[model samples]
Each structure stands twice: as structure tokens, then as C-alpha cells.
Target: MRSPQLRDATSPTGCALTATTALARLPALAPCLPEFSDIVPWPRRRGCRADAVVGWGQRPTTARARQWALRHQLPFIALEEGFLRSWGPAAEGYASHSLVVDHSGIYYDASAPSDLESLIEHGRISPEDELRASGLIARLRHSRLSKVNHAPDIPLPASPRPRVLVVDQTRNDASIVGGLADRQRFHQMLDHALTRHPDADILVKVHPEVIAGRRQGHLEHAGRHPRCQLLADDINPWALFDAVQAVHVVTSQLGFEALLAGLPVTCHGLPFYAGWGLTTDHLRCPRRHRRASLPRLFAAAYLHYSRYANPYTGAPSTLEDTLDLLEDQQRHIDAGRGHWRCHGLSRWKQRFVGDFLGPKACVSHHSQGRFEPSAVATSTERQLLWGSQIPAATGVSRMEDGFLRSVGLGIDLVRPLSLVIDRCGIHYDPGRPSELERLIAHGRFSPRELARAARLIQQLRQHKLSKYNPHHEPSRLPELPGNRPRLLVVGQVESDASVRLGAGRIRTNAQLLREVRRTRPDAFIVYRPHPDVMAGVRQGAQVSSDDWDRLVADVDITTLIDRVDEVHTMTSLTGFEALIRERRVVTYGMPFYAGWGLTQDHVPAPDRRGRKISLEQLVVAALIRYPRYVDPCSRQLINVETAVQLLASARQNPPELTLFQRLYRLTRRYLHGPY
Candidate 1:
């Protein structure tokens, strides 16, 4: 007998998929239980009585076994994909897959009592649980329920055309067979879609599995039509949903996802999500006849009905844990999946990030146009573009990271802010609305979320946290002659991508400072140049003391901010930090934090930032909810509390540099010349 490090527990019906998970969660099954596969035939051929039976719900095979289990007076545990968002592909139920292993009745079965709705009424959910649920919803909207690819956008025709999408499912799935649908075939759904929406352009999208050729779908053999087009592109499902006016489905998960994405869904089947008054349903189930809001439905399905295991530890986890795991998984897959040549990275920088990033992925330093462009484009998985802007490469996906930098505190040598990892691109570039901005602008913050945001804001304020560490001691400011309101003009790199994309009217630091002087001439103006420009790593327009009344350096920014009544900037995070301190802020550009009605705005982000919300709500959505943090020592996924503590400790006691790091610093300084 094996030591049981990996358990192979089975149910009485023996209709279960293989689950290779950690030993900690192995269920208590009979020691003498036979293998699951062996018991599949015995339930139908010979009657056997047992305590319980476990199987995935609604499949043809499992449905029969479940009936047998009920007939024999045994309890049945129904397994299904957790109705909430998932990190990876949910269709494949392998090890490390998140699931809803429910003991109460399965959600889709109309005849049985529901575990999901009961939890909404009676479950003892905590504040943290609510926070997790809110975070999951935000991620779904921001990343479009995808952990892997964010930029998988397939642009549609530019010609004006109204489009309606009909999402297809695998022919043999349990959802169709067991959900009591009128027609399970994709062709039947297509004909109905064409007839219902005559004026609109109809696009039939097949499941990802069908595209991969792993399984057969109804449209596999159906001849293509001139009016209706079958789409098998690699575009993300969420993107497809966004492009279409409405979505039609028969027991497909896409219908549920489309509803969450705020699309009108017409369902031909009685899936769990349909008949809830949210979607227009052709088939009705009495169980879900009660009307419900999206959030309440999300709470019932995600927080109550499902169980999640930690992606890192394999222990049972929460929604917060799932977010962290998904972020980690996203970073890992992005970094480790494709073979690529990294551009614009120094040898030392490569070594620095590579050690922490592990060796599963390939990283090579090659100058632009040095490698064979054709070979590099075709051979590797994705091109790792290491900069503020993406390269001109046409074909491959771009895995954008901010060149092995951290966002935490103290010297950049030891403690770092968390590494920025984005599948499409980094957050600062306003070329497209970054995920953080999307979350802040569109995400709904509940009362519990607002409370959590309040706590995080308190932490940031008490600790005097800003984007960069305060390397110098707090110095006394020049005393203002009178009590006239003081103004601080924040400066940033003129050539930075954020300025190019977001700094709409006033482009440079000097221009912003001059504008501030013209606007508030009487107010005592203080200008602080960007640290990167001062360090000579980045360039900015010159701003002498003549440009502003006073130019300050070698002093803590917190001290400078304290002496001023107002802070002005063009898309600097400093403006947001000042907002944290409750100071009056005016913006020349639409930074992610701006346009929320919290700051005096000079530009418009009307489409992106129209959802009027509170400052506490913004903090919860951006800091507590959006950003991913990692422990510096353990290199593991961590919560916001742990990240804050690590940064605080780094600020208090700056870590000493090793000899090699010191040498590297010296070499880098000599190579870059003076600031």
C-alpha cells in the first residue's frame, strides 16, 4: 500500500473524475474502497448499498448513477465548476482546478433544493468574505474573467454594422443534457437567432475547446452561411461579448458570463443563471423564478455554493486567495510560457529579475534588429517587451513588465514596490485604459468595501506613504511670510509615456508649473522635480527656481506636502498621495485617480471615469482591490496587510547593500553619467 500522500478516495456510485490534489483535503472514504473506474458498471448491473455517492451533476453517465444512489437511499454529493470566476480553464477538471464540490443540491437541477440561494439568506458571511466577493467581481470586469491573456483582442470590421452573437457549447456537455433545454444543437440555436434578430449581423462563436480541436462541436460539420459567420478566432470571450449587442445561448457558461458583463442574454435552456429575471428565457424553471440582482446572485453562487483551494498551498481558501493565485498564475504563465528574447534589459537586470522569476521561462538579451526577426517572431511564444511602450513587432503577444522594479519603500536596492506585470501592457500608459483605471471607474464598492478602504487609507496616511521612498531626512520649509494659501507644483518626466498619453494640454513639468503660476500667482508656489529625472535615468523640461518661486530638494516630500494647502500636477501619483492626506488637488491631465470627482479635473475621461464614487471607495478599488503584492523574502503571493508591513519595516530600517550590489550601483551610475 502506498503511504497515501496522494489519496484516491471514491464514492459509492464510483462516477467521479480523477482529482490529484494535496493530501490535506483527501476525503474520509472507506479504506477498502475499490478504484472509482471499477465501480462505474456495478451500480447499474448489481445493486449495492453504501453511505454516499459522489459525481459531477447532470451528465448522462452521472445522472444515471445519481438516480441509482437516490433509489438505494444514499446521499449524493454533486460536483460542478464553481459558478464564480476561475483562474484557469474550468472545462478540464484536473488537479489544481477550482470546483464546487457541493453536498446540498446542485444549483442547476430544478427539482432539488438549492444550496446557493439558501446561503444568500442564512449563511454567516463576514466582512472579509464580502471584500473578496467584491474583488472577484472587479477582476472579472477588468481582466474579463481571464487570467492568461488580456490583449487577445480581435478587431471587427470598421463598417457600421449591428451585430448579435450566439455562443455555442460542446455537443456532449452535461449542462445541455441535464439542464432540460429544448434544443442542445448549435445549428438549432443559430436558426432561431437569425429569425429573431433579422436586421443584425449574426456571428456564431464556438467554444475554445472546439477551436483547439480537442472536442467536436455542432458547427464542426455545418456548412458556412453567407449571412451568419462562424468565428473560431483567438479573441477572448469577454471581448466577443463586448463587441456584440446581445448574446444567445443554450445552457452555455457564456450566457452567465455575458450577463455579468452587462449584456442582454436570451436563453433557450434552464441553466442555473437563466430564469432569474435577469436574462430573457424561453424555457422556465420554478426554482430560479425569483428575481435577483447581479451582486446578490454573485454572492450566492461564489461565496456560498462553492469551495476554493489555495493556488499556492492547496488548502481550502477564500476569494481573496483566489485573486492572489490568479495574479500569480497570470505572472507565471506570462513569464514562463513563451520562449522569447528580452529587449532593452541590461545583463545585470536580467540576472536580478530572472533569479526571482525562476527558470521555467526563457529570457535572453538581444538588441533590436540583432536577432533574425522572422525566426524570433515565429519560434518563440511571446515577445517580452520591457519598457513603457510596446515594440513595433506585429505578430506576437507582448508580456510587459517594468524591468524588474518594485513599488514598496526605502532604497530601490533591497525593498521594492511589487513588480508590475501586465499581459497587455503596464498601467501608466493611457494609450488604452489600464486595468486599475477600469476597476476604479466602473467597479461598485459596497459599504463593507468602503470600510476596508477606510482602513487601508488610514494605514497609508499614518505611515506617510507615497510612491517612492523618502531617502532624506525631513527638512524645515522656508517660512511663508503670510497665511496666504501655499501651492506645490508636482513635476514628472516630460518624455515618459504617461505624459504622452495622459498629459493632455499641459505636457511638461515647466509648462504645468508656469500654468500654476499664471492661475495662482499670489499663492506661494513650490516645485519638486521628478526623482528619476534628478537621478538622470529619465529626462524632463528644465524648471529653475525662476520658473517657480522656490525649488526644493533633499527633503521629505511628506514634509513639503504638509506645508502646502494645495498640490497641482499632470497625471502624477503624487496628486493621489496628496488626496490621501485630504489636500486640495488640481490636475492638468487625466491620471487614473483623477476624473473621479475627488480632484479638480482639467481633462475628461468621460467614458472611463464617470461613476461618481467616494475617496474611500477609490482606495478600496485601486489599492486594496486591484494591485498584487508579493513578500520580498518568501517570493510568495501576499495580502495588502503583509505588503504594508514589509514596506513600513523597509522604510524604518533600510537594508544594507551587499558588495556586489554596491559595485553594480557604482557601475550603473558611471554608465549613466550625472543627473
Candidate 2:
């Protein structure tokens, strides 16, 4: 044996020249030496003492040489961080020696910066160094350097089941290193691998930095499974390659290493090694070439490698191990739970102050059993609690109290009654309407004044009728014969009054009267008010005769006409009545009748045949197709059937006037505006 001559070197460039000089002295080392850079040609001699020489760096030449060694099955050593930073955590098991070289020359302290300048000054490492040679000593100390001369020649393990290794960097919390989808798939693939290979041992290698406590847990449930062995301690990954059969991963660079080891790899996701004709891919890679070679694959990786720059150091690491390390670092950061503290805070603030004085609180309390209020009482109190055309009555003290309590306000200047009246549709801007109307002859009184005036007008009309005729007219008039079919109109008269009066309801009335008169010269069209409309009337208050007259005048149908032989409608309950009365009915739209093949419908029902259907069935489908009754205050949907049942029960056992007043008071507090 002879001592190799040591040469002084300056730059990393100088180190290469010095290495060439050293190789010149030891002609036996030529074979082990990596293919020289463009500056140095291949040695003329065939036989050399050096079986192989390994180098590590975050550059193209060092990476190319690493790939060449793997392709040639040459034993090589690599620092874990350099390899991870180049290719990712998956490359940990690929090389003969996987060493962790901390920046401070410590074994596992990744926080320290490398002493590359000191090494350069000492001439031990060159100034033009491709990588920090200071860490190399530490790496070699912890690595399988003694076995490099005579690499172990163990055969691949023989197992009936497939061998799989899961490589990931752990963090403080049990989260997957990759994105959500990647994490989920990784778990699924792990489960699949275990199920497919029941007797197989799945090796899970934690990132060296993660094992050293720089990061946290990333494996989650995968790390705890009986089949999985967490490789937290430092061990030569190549030894596992000799023991295991195959490798499984989720886009890990380990797939590439497994390929070099001549081991089969199953990739659950699109890793850089996937679609390179190297691994058994579980996912398709869009950038994959149809026919891939080692050199072509390297070209693709090298070309795309320029896109990334290390966020921490701002340096670029093109080597496979370097990319792996960088990716693992990012994964560690992402998996940490503290990363989401700011995000959670932002969302919490948004929802906290969104609704300070809205219907949501009232409804939420009512739904949660903290409060109970009758539906009718709620509706009536709502009408009065908020200012409306009608003034609050003296006996409605309880209602006022309830409104105040509901709004969390006392009887101050800002009373609930005042707020309601101020905000109500009719009471808004009282001064403008009253002052302007009184000043101008054409102007009308304020809504409150108008309501009072209307009441007086109705009283006078009733007084005159009582003073004269002394008898009220029959609610329904006698039926009459008509040339055209007679039609009846009905439904939510107040809400859809404009539409019904303008369209089908009025049209049916006018057309029936005209056609009947033109054909038989004598026919009748009946207009029936809804039961709910009639029930809305308050006793002792005179009806608006003018409003009634106006409604009749707007429709061309004759008010005197009574009998309805045929009915036309949109979705009015009058159609249902007409159906019960055996009058022929025609539906212009999907007015529920259009589907029941019984009536002459203008619109055809796509789902219904000529089959007769019960009125209850029609009502159920229309009202209960997953119907949700939303609380006007809360805007949250309540159980539809429960609401309906409550309404029916209330109708069956109507509350007394005193009980009603109590309920009105209680409900007024919770009733604000319709949500």
C-alpha cells in the first residue's frame, strides 16, 4: 500500500485540477474516478486501482455522475440532506451510504450553517467547491464508508409478498407532507399495499432532519400500523434494499432509487420517476414521453429543474437528492399545525360580528327550545311591533313589552314601536306624505292617515246601509246560464294580487264572460276570495268598500255572475274548488292541475299520465318535496311537517283572546323583519 499525495487546492475549480493531479499519481484509481469534466479527457490506461469515486453537490456535473454510478451499479456515498435536497426524501435509500451532514459539522443539527469558508481557507476544501466539503467528513463518519471498497453483494430478498417503503418527513402534528389529496391517496395506497401483501413488512423512513427534531410527525396513522416499521434511527437504507422486495410510494424520489437498485417500484402518484418506464405507475404522468430512456429522462428533469429556487438560501439545487430535500422541507412546514393559526383567526372574526341586531338570534333561540311563541301571535305582533298603517292599540301593552324585550331595549326614546313605525313600509317618511299631500290638493295623506280615512269611509258606508236597507246582501248570488264556460278565481290574493289581476285570473274572468255572452248571450263568471283572506278581517273595523270596488273594476268579469261551469287558473286554490264542484278546468301552466290528467290542461305534465290522482297526493308533492319552513327571523329552515302540524293543532284548539294576547306579547320580542 502507498500513501496518496495531498495537493493544495483553492477554488472548487482548483479542487478538480488537484484531483486530476492526485489521480495522475495513483494510476490504479482511474477506473473508480468519475468520468472527467470537459477539461480532462478519459485516462489512456485501461486498468486502475480505484474501483469507483463518488462526489456530492447541488449541480449538474455531480448529479450526472451520481446517475451514471447508479446506472452502472457502482457503490456511492451521499449526504442525506444533499440527496434529499436534490431528489426528495425518497432518494434516502438509493445510495450505499445515506449520511446526515449538518451545516455546523454536527451529526443532526440542520439549523447550523456549513463551514465551507473554513474548509476552503485550510486548503482541505477548494474555494470553487461544487458542494460544502466541510460536511463531507461528518457524513463519511456516520456512513458505510468502510464497505465502499468492497460493497456487500447480497441478493434481493425473496418474499411471496411485495415489499414497500413509505418515505416522508414528519412534523409536530400528524399530517401528511404533501397536499390533502396526496396525503389521502398515500394512506389509501398504504392500506392497499398492506391488504395486497398481508405478510410483507413496510419500511417507513423518516427524513433525517425530521428524526433529528427539526420537523414533526408526518406519517399519521401509517406510522402506527403493525405492518409499518418507523425507521426513526439512523440506518443504512441500502441494507433495507437487500432485505425488501419492492418499493411503494406517492410521488417519492425513492421510486428512482428503487429503479437503480433493480427493484420493482409501485407509485401511487405521479413522481418524477413515474412514466419514465422505470416504475409500476398507479397514476398517469401527462409530461411522460411515450418511449423513455435514462438519458432522455435526465434531460427532461434537468430542463424542468431550473424553475425552482430554494426559498431559504436562494440557492438552486439541481441534484436529485437536493430537490428531494427541499420538497421535504416544504412538506414539514406545511404539515405543522401552527401554520393555520392565522387562517383560523381571520375566519373567526368574520362570523363573530356579522349579525349584531338581526333576526338570527330570535329564530335561533326559538328553534333551540329556549323560547316558544305561537305562529299566529308572532305574525300579528310582527304587524304591530314594527310600525304599520294601523296604530298600536291601548290594550296591546304586553305586545309593546315583548317587542322591547326581543330587541334588548328598554322603554327609552328609541322604543321598539318607534323603530318599527320608522322602518315600516307604510309609516316611513310620514311628514313628507302628509305635509305634501295637505299642501297640494292632488297629494294623498300619510299611510297612517290614509288608513284612518279609509276606516271612516267604510263606517259611513255601513251606517248608510244600516240606516236604509237594514239587511246585508247574500254572500253568494244565484247561478246563471252562460253561452261561454264560467271560471272562478282564487289564491294568495294580497301577495299575487297584481299578477293574478293582470294575467290568468283576470284573463279567465274576462274571456269566460265575453265568450259566454257571445255564445249563449247569458253566462256568469264567479270570483271567490280565499278563506285565508276572509279570516284576515278584524271585527268591528269597517271594510274598505272602495278597495273592494276597485278590485272588481280591474277585472272585466261581471261581479253579479255566480255559476262557474269551467275554471282557468295559474295555481289558485279556486281551481281545486272548481275541480270539487265538477266544473271543467283548464290550466295554462304547471298549476298542479296540469299534471293530474283529469282537467283540460294547456301545459302537459312530463311525469304524469292520464292516471287520476287524489287531491292529498297533489298537495303532499307540492308542499312536501323536502319542504323546509324557514323562520322569518332566523332565516333557518325548520321542519316543514312540524310547522304544518303546529298550524293544524292551533286551528283545532284556538287560543282565547287573553292567551292570544299573552302569546302576542311573548312573540313580539322575537319577531323583527322577515329574514
Candidate 3:
């Protein structure tokens, strides 16, 4: 987020823009628009000049861009920030993820046919986009995402009186003038709302810009009405929708959002979404002849009409990418809104855990001896003990390492990009039903979620990404003695929580190896120790030369899993990764994936996890739906797909640790003996 005042047209993503500096001046819009340099004519022109003229909706600079297009006799494109912009208003420096680049007219203006309107009227939407639209809409509602997503999600008035919402817009907003409305329309809209819902109290919603003191709204005086209450705070629109019975608007985008939320909407002004039979529009457009479904309109407006950027990277992106990014942003921000008292995390883990908790969070580390009862000074503060540490009390939550963890070994002090904060229980522990187990049992596998999981699986296979994707490979595994079903015995730190809690009777690598040798005496067994154990930084079970044919050292986990015919694990994540790669997994202990029909289990799964789930379900719950990931490139909260993509990219190798950092890691590992 660079200062908008910077003259260069390049965006924060470091890509050149699609519009001239006149339009790309707002750094926030640069992602949507990708290589414009010369709105400010240089004394001498240099590189390639912009081919087509572009401008944002109705700005003073846009008027100049339009004049330039007219003088040059070229087509002028109108670009407006798309419906799902960012967490907050543009004025607040939150950048835009989506932008509507219209060749005809902008989407907000109903005075003429915009591309969105044309698409709604006569454009064809493919069945795929329609289905995608339904999924996107469902996610939008589920996420409670409105155009600007940074608003505080607070509960609206809980009075028994049915609430009728009145959405107010900035005075003389371009949509107001273009959609055939004026200041008087706000008054009329309010009066109509009062008349139509006499029993309902009016909840007047103010524009974000108005609340910021940067702009004025048409209904600023509406608070004078005894029944009308001004909602001056930047409240989350979807949350507000939940409390309101119906919404009334004069060209405010909240009307469109209300429709998306399945609330009855009355549009007093002819905005682009109005007159499409979706909303009860008092003002209609003859050009909008065809009735529109919510998905159709959303597809036309979001999928077909708008362009998006991989907010983390400057590359062109899809609507789904934006949804994931925004959802993570909200989750991070909302979590940070609370006070956190964290206990039992190693010194190396403190900074990375803070990243998942979000920036605004107030977090204090409480090592065993350092924790004081009164340290939780505020009544509002919450405690999150390390997951798998049986808590003495109930109010605290649990935090653990997520499945798609990081690029380097966690023992090497490589901060993880993903983590799980479970209020229910840690996923690895099947001693009792964890949150992940409950999701496996009760969660429905929608087609959209399953498809996403399927893609993630493909990516994981293509990228060869495992929890800690270190760049090490052992010499080619010794050619199997007879190609007799080869078995891989993956070892873990004996003291690790997963082993202690999840490994039931087979609690140690020594036990796991003995069990495998006894069960399959004929098979050639390859034993690989945990990276930390191999590095001599952690305790490991003793291994004998007679236990296996090959004692592998520093081997890549992915390569090891691929080479094996079957995997033997007592609560190691290697078992889970093996399952994802479609290899046979025999779980001696009760790791999260063992109970499902997908793996051969020596121990019975918790009775609560009775529902038979697919690998796709497991992938969705563990990778897509569960963990929180931060993009290493941007250090911003990101989706699993983006995380995997970043890890897979050849250019995304993590920087070499500074000498001081290396020494620090070495000193800490030796002094503390690994976390």
C-alpha cells in the first residue's frame, strides 16, 4: 500500500498498470488495472505509451482521460472499483482486489448500458460460471462480505420490533446522478420505508465515507425522526442484514448486497442491479428487459465483468482467489480483535503464532514459571494454551501446527505459514474427538468444497508439498530386495505431542518399527527418522541395524512416501501426506486420518467419527477448510492454494538466514533441545 501521491504507475505488487497515472494514481486500483505510465506527459516520452484511454468512474481526472480519448479518436474505457474491493474504504488505504473495466460504460451508471447491464440483459453465462456463481455467493453470505469488508461485525439492535434498514449514500455520488436520483430521493426513500413498514423501526445506515468525515450523506438529518436511529458506525452490512427484515436504498450498493443476503430490497433509484426483477425497484430501466437471478447478476458483475489481482502477487487472478484472501483477512482481523494470553509455545514459535492471531491482537507469552494468575489483567482477555496440553480449565482455546506448514523444517526456526486455533481440540489428538474429527463426522462435502479440495490435491502432487517442504533428498533408496511390497517406517520425536497423545499403544518409533517388522517380516523396510532427530536436536527412539534394510538419512518426505508401497506410522504427519499421495497408509495409532475409511487402522477410531469420509473431505478439512496460511511473499494471510503455489514456484526459495539468525537458531536448538 504505497502512498497514492506517488507519480509512478506501478502498483505495490511491482507490476506496471493498465491505465495512465491519472487513473492508476490511486495505488489501490493498480492491481485491477495492470501497465499505465504516462498520464503525466513527460518532457520527452520514453517506453511504450498506453494504447487505449482508461479512467475510473466520473472522477475529475477521468474527465481529462475521456477528453484525451476523444481528441485521439480512440475508445475510452471506464474502470470503476469492483463490488468486492477490500477490507475497508479506499480512503483508508485498503487496496482493491476487483475492478470493473468496462468498454461501454461503468457498472454503477444506469444512465447508459454498462457491460454488467448488457450481460444481464443479453449476454450468455456458461453453466460453469453459473454454478461457480452459486458457490461464490454462498461463500460471500457465509463470510458476510459486503463490498468493503473491513467493517466491525457487531450485532445490530436486538429489539423485538422488526427493523427496516434505510441505506444512505454520499450526497451527489456518481451512482445517484447516473441512476436518476437526487438528494430528495433519500428523503423519499426514508418516508416510503416508514410508510411501508409502519410497525418496524428504521435503522438508517450511513455511508463509510460519510462516517470517515471525508464525505456527506443525504440522510444525515434522519436521526431527527423519533423512530429513525442513525447507524454511524462502520458496521458489517451482512451482519446488519441479519437483524433487519427489509432494506430500502437510493442507489446504495447495500441494496444489492441485501439482495445477495436474500433480504427483501426496495430500490428507490435505478442502480445497475435494480429493475432486474431481483429487487422491488420503484425506478426501472427499460433496457433491463430480462429477469436476473442473484447468481447470474453476480457472475456478470463479478466473474465476467470485473478483473481481479492476486493481492499477494500482481498477476491476474480469479474471483475465487479474492474471496479466499478476503475471508482470511477477516478471520485474522476478527481473531486479533480479542486479547490473547498464550502459554506453552516455544520461543521460536512466538512470532509466527502472532502472525496468525493478526496485528491488532494483544498477546503475552506465559511460560510455565512466568505465568501469573493476575496476568490476565483484563476481563475480556482470552487464554490459548498449546494444543494437546490437557487444560486444567475450560475457557482457553488450543493452537497447533497446521498440515501445510512451511518451506523449511520447523526445527530450523523457519516460521510456519499456517496454524490451527481450535476451540474444540487439536486435530492430531484422536484420544478424544477433535474439531477436525467433528468436521469429518458432521460436515457436508458440497460440490464446490470437494472440487476445491480436488484441485489442492492435484497441486500438492504437482508441487510435492508436505508439512515441512525442506530441500533435501537422500541417495536413491536402495533398490528393493525383491520388489516385495516395500514398507516405509517414518519416525517422529518420541516426546512430540502427536506421538505421546495419538500413538495409543505404539507410542514410540521403536515400537512402530518392531510392530511393522513383526507384522510384515517378509517385506523390505526402510526407516527414516524425523528431521530434528537426524539433526541431533531432539530425542528419538533407538534404532538397530537389524530393524530395516535401509536406514535413510536426510531424505525428502515426499520422495520417501512416493518410493514406498505402504507407509507405517504411529501418529506422524507422514501418514497423512502418504494418504494424500494415494499410497496405502497403515496407522498404528489414532492420528486424525486413521479412523476414516481411507486408512488401515490398528486402533479403533473414536465412536464419534462414525461417518465415512472421502480423501477429498479430509483434504478440505485439513488443508482448505481448516488451517490459516500466510503468504511468504506478502506475509499476509492467504489460502492453501496460494501457499502451495508460492512454495512450488522456483523463484520463491526462502532467503538464506543471516549469520546472526543462523547462530541464534543453533544456540536456541542446542540450549532448548528443540520444540
Model 1 C-alpha lDDT versus the unseen true structure: 0.61
lDDT of 2 by residue, 1-675 (tens): 111112111212211121123223322122112232212212421233233333332223345545654565554332222222221122322221122221232211112212321222222222222232223222323332222211222344466655677665444211122211244675677777787678788877665566566665456446678778776655445665667777776655555555545578887765444555767777653434454544333323322111222222222222222323322222222222121101111232223211221212221111112222233243423211222212322211111111111111121111111011111122111212211112222223333223333433333222221100111234534434455544453333333322332234333433433443344333344444433233332111223322211122122122222245666555553454344344576554344344555576644544423445543343332222211232223222222222332233333443333564445444543452111
Looking at candidate 1, the ten consecutive residues that score lowest on lDDT are 23-32
Best by TM-score: 3
Candidate 1 residue 297 C-alpha distance from true site, Å: 2.0
TM-score per candidate, chains pooled: 0.49, 0.24, 0.85
Of the two candidates 1 and 3, the one with more favorable TM-score, higher being better, is 3
The lDDT for every candidate, in the order shown, is 0.61, 0.35, 0.77
Task: Sort every candidate by TM-score, greatest first.
Answer: 3, 1, 2
| Candidate 1: tens digits of C-alpha lDDT, residues 1-675 | 001212234433343321112221332111222234332223233443345566655555466657766687666666665554443332332233245655677766645566664554455656555655566677778755543333344567643677898877777666675567533446677888888888878888875678789887776543366667778765767778767899988877778778778889988876777766888887766545466666666766766665555332233445554554455445544444445566655454565444333334565666655644466445645455554533444443333222112332222244443444444444565556665667776678767557756867787777766666555655455665456778988888776666877888899887887788888878888888887556544445677566687777555676678778999999888887888888999999977788778999888765766777788977876676555455555454444544565566667875555796567556655565322
Predicted structure 1, TM vs. truth: 0.49
In terms of lDDT, the best-performing candidate is 3
